[model samples]
Target chain A: MNRMILYKEWLKTRWFLLAAFLVLAAGTFYMGLSLSKTVQFNGADKLWEVLVSKETVLLETLKYLPLAVGGLLAVVQFFPETARKRLKLTLHLPYPQGRMMAMMYGYGLAALTILFLLQATVLTVSLRHYFVTELVVRIMVTAAVWYLAGYAAYIWVAAVCLEPTWRMRVVVIVLLAALVRLLFLSGVPESYNGILPWLVLYVLCGQVLIFHSVARFKEGLQD
Target chain B: MKKIGKIFIGLSLALLVLWLVPWVYRIVTLESYSTPFTLYSCVVHDFTSLDRSDARNFRFIDRKGNVYGDEVQPLFYHSILASKGAFPDSLEGIPVTEEMVEHNSVILSAEPKEFNVKKAPVYLLMESVPVRLELHDPEDAFVVRKNGLAVYRMADNTLLEEKTGRFNAALSAEGFRFPANLVAGKPSHHKEYDEGYLLTDAEGKLFHLKQVDGEPVVRHFPAADSLDLRQILITEFTNRATLGYLVDRDNRLHMLRPDGTVIPTEVRYDPAREDLLVVGDLFYYTVKTSDADGEHFFALRSDDFSLVDRMDRPYDFEEEVNLCKYVFPCRLSFTSSDDGWVKPRFSDFSWIGLVVDLLVAVFIIAWRWRRKNTNN
Candidate 1:
């Protein structure tokens, strides 16, 4: 039954997952290629020096790609389902509603994780070919918060979708926006370095927000 | 379980409101007042302020009612001239000249380095091009790791095995241990010559580090046993003034000379909050430090670190907010001007918010109890 639910969720998200992957891949490649052209013009040594002294993270263009992809993925997968009350039909299945909801969200999350890892791996490999391990890690660590913001977006957008009224959704969205802003508070590279593990925990705990929305939805608190 | 989740969300929303409302109100209504740009003068035996609090208006005056450059250029130019010995008869009748001020002037600043938010300690060592103070294209950059255990070049991201080995060996030869405490340097092309970095070893000993001809040059400086050194700043001044100032564990400032010696200055350091500016002329080294308590100006002679004159002014600037603070006596701010961190830090505390919270709580409980009694 969970497998069937997972299949249903995949049916909704598979195309978005592909598009998100390609967009991120293209962005990563463009940045790496730009760095290559720069190095060709002014040797790798100068580039490394600027990164060290100025804390310049060369992959700034790619910073918002994951965030945009995550939020869009959530909207694509859940909005239509909740729009026509399709979730009501799914709830009537013999499978427990909680398990069914978990299966659906879990599948979407797993797919996003795979996409982000793909993006991370491709960028890290390309960066390593030119720069050293320390710079490579610094770039990756700086991207950690933006990537986690993807999961937060997914979970929060799911809550907004589960909400049964426009008034509640507006308030919830404002709160979600404030929450998202927290993830991007500092553009200083690696400002999020030591705080990442706890941030991950905070994002994971945010999963409960959607469960609360689901409970409220089942209570039929409609506008 | 569902009820608990709902309550958790409610509490979080409340906390967010608690943090936001007061901060927003204060931001919208608060008026700002700051003291003038002040510097100490040994010649005048008081603080000299360039007061420009009013827009498009400025006055240069001593605390003793002496004024300078009333109609044209400010008296600051005259002070600068005196400090540099250009003005034979200074406004305050001090004996100074250009040559004496050029060689003797030094700046000792002690603004604590805030590492609350970590940045990659990556530095670009610009090539020493022909012109001094001219920024050069970087040939390489470097980061010291694990207490100077290794120095890796950033270009190809490889260890400059020979340079690293030389530095490590030199420090070991100097009887210093691994994992240095503090490493300070200014690696830009904007200086006369690079002093490289000042490293304090694991056991709190001082050493100088510089790169010459792509080689590591290390010099060990015998330090005072009570040094408890915390931070260092390296200035590549034209006069090759003292290497830089160091802040010790006891919140005291010291100067490190070029020949690897230390002089404990009379300046007090407030690690919590310290803003210091040191100006040097041929005759006196004027140091100004400002903090919550007030502004302190001290002038010490260039030859010996003896207090020539001192000024202590009490700045109770917070009293300006006493009337309007009833609206917000305290605010929970995640980030502070002092450091770069987004953690819950309560600031601007007063008795106002406490009384308000207690009163609000009492009213709520009383209303709930009254409702229960009416139902019974």
Candidate 2:
């Protein structure tokens, strides 16, 4: 209900903001260097061509970093500190558990958005040298799917860590990996090259699973 | 009390089955079974042992004999040889070009938004196995089994060795049995570069066939060193059998083995003799040539590192050419030569049909689930 509270807290988390910025910076540098080289060699001067080319190079490098770091950070980012503090703070928060959970997810998603936008900007810059077309549209679709998947991963880790038992977390992660492999194996024969669909399906399923955390949240620093 | 419980249970079960349709449909109607024809492919190598990757393609034939088509994927060598990701298209983007559509002589009328025609078509069924190249001829393309021996049609409808074994055993193991109505023909009119053979049934169902030279006793080998036995060769090797070879565009050699192992060799090929020679790039094979007075040894360069010469005969051995060229390579080079045959192992599209069946089951289940939900 109070979305602004979540957004404000996300802005207040200095470490999280810094991490997001670093990811964007690294992504931009990688794209800039790659684009310069591509222009020198291929002469891809159209805005669309440059955008697709540079953005692809940039986002590909930045894609996995967010998922991995975001997942780990979810455990600590806004997690209540002590058992007493959790009751006094998270439990006594000014919103229903659903809205609070939504805020956490919102923050994670915001971080991912920033990273993708930076990567997309670099891609657009590269495309400007090439041509003006719907290259940005293609890049947006690809980057959005990737960032959403990463955000889901972050939320999943944060919620799992809130629950007690590291062993259970490990078990859940392994199970999730196995399910993804099954989906891939099932989809492959139908697809000519099955990997893309597998990737897309994993992100979709991950996002779905992340929503479950929101549906079943408890205000506790420890189980 | 018992009567009421039974009535409630029966109604719930009926409703539960109705809610499962869409999921069933999604699985059942996958791309594999969307088309009517079974696709068969092989790679055609150039004079050099390296395959012309772009030259990779497939052979398709319908069960009714009404349709046949050839789909050519892009060149294989460009990506590997260039060591650049700048390959024309990703394996998914490999297209059914005008050339491919024209090659099979199948009419092209429909264009859809789903597929990327310029790029992004499925090339190899498995990336490791190069997409099968349709040998040059359309109608002359044939794959058949005779007296338990696998046979393929060469240029001009000439029967050539393809594979051998108890056909029933291999087909059943591969989850494919011979089709009921068998038809036979070359894939296309051009046989100039195509040294392999093909076989089809009356219903247009197809299989790879070839004959081995030695004894009536059948021999079996693994199809590839990497994959499990189920995927190697289709079935157990039985007596009265022959061996089969597929020269892929990447110069990767696929040989069907007994006990169902598909052995992929890094050998070179001589298409004229339909033999696989293990000669490397720096090495050469010596074939004997006959002059008017005497026979002289001729040296043929083996630059591409192929397992077999693309022909049945050695390139320099035969004088008159044509069929003799088919025999020369078989006699010379590499290990003691077995009478080698080549056939296109048609993709087991039966999986797609299974998917469709599963979709129907899901649809029924979904409908029943929704009905129960509504009742509750």
For model 1, the stretches where C-alpha displacement exceeds 4 angstroms are B53-58, B70-86, B89-116, B123-138, B316-330, B349-355, B358-376
What is candidate 2's CA lDDT for residue B98? 30
Q: Summarize candidate 1's per-residue lDDT along B1-376 as a digit string, tens digits.
A: 3575566566566656667877777678687767766665544556677757543455667876776432222132456545555554443455545555555556556553343346565555544433455555555555656656556555566777786677678778877777777777777665556677787878888887666656656788876446888767776666765777787878787877787778888877665476777777555677888876777877776666667777887785555444324644466656555555555666677688668767887999899999999999
TM per candidate comes to 0.88, 0.34
Task: Estimate, for each residue in A159-207, the C-alpha lDDT of model 2 and write its tens digit.
Answer: 4544344554464465444332222221111222223454455444444
For chain B alone, what TM-score does every candidate structure achieve against the true structure?
Answer: 0.82, 0.19
Top of the candidates by DockQ: 1
Q: After superposition, how far is residue A30 of candidate 2 from its true place, in Å?
A: 2.3
Per-residue lDDT for A1-223 in model 1, tens only?
A: 7677878888888888888888988898899889989888877877776666564578888878878887898898889878888978887889888887788788778888999998899888988887767778988888888899898888888878877878767766876787677787766767666567877887787777777777878888888
| Model 1 deviation from the true structure expressed as Cα RMSD, one decimal place | 3.7
TM-score of chain B of 2: 0.19
lDDT of 1 at A40: 84
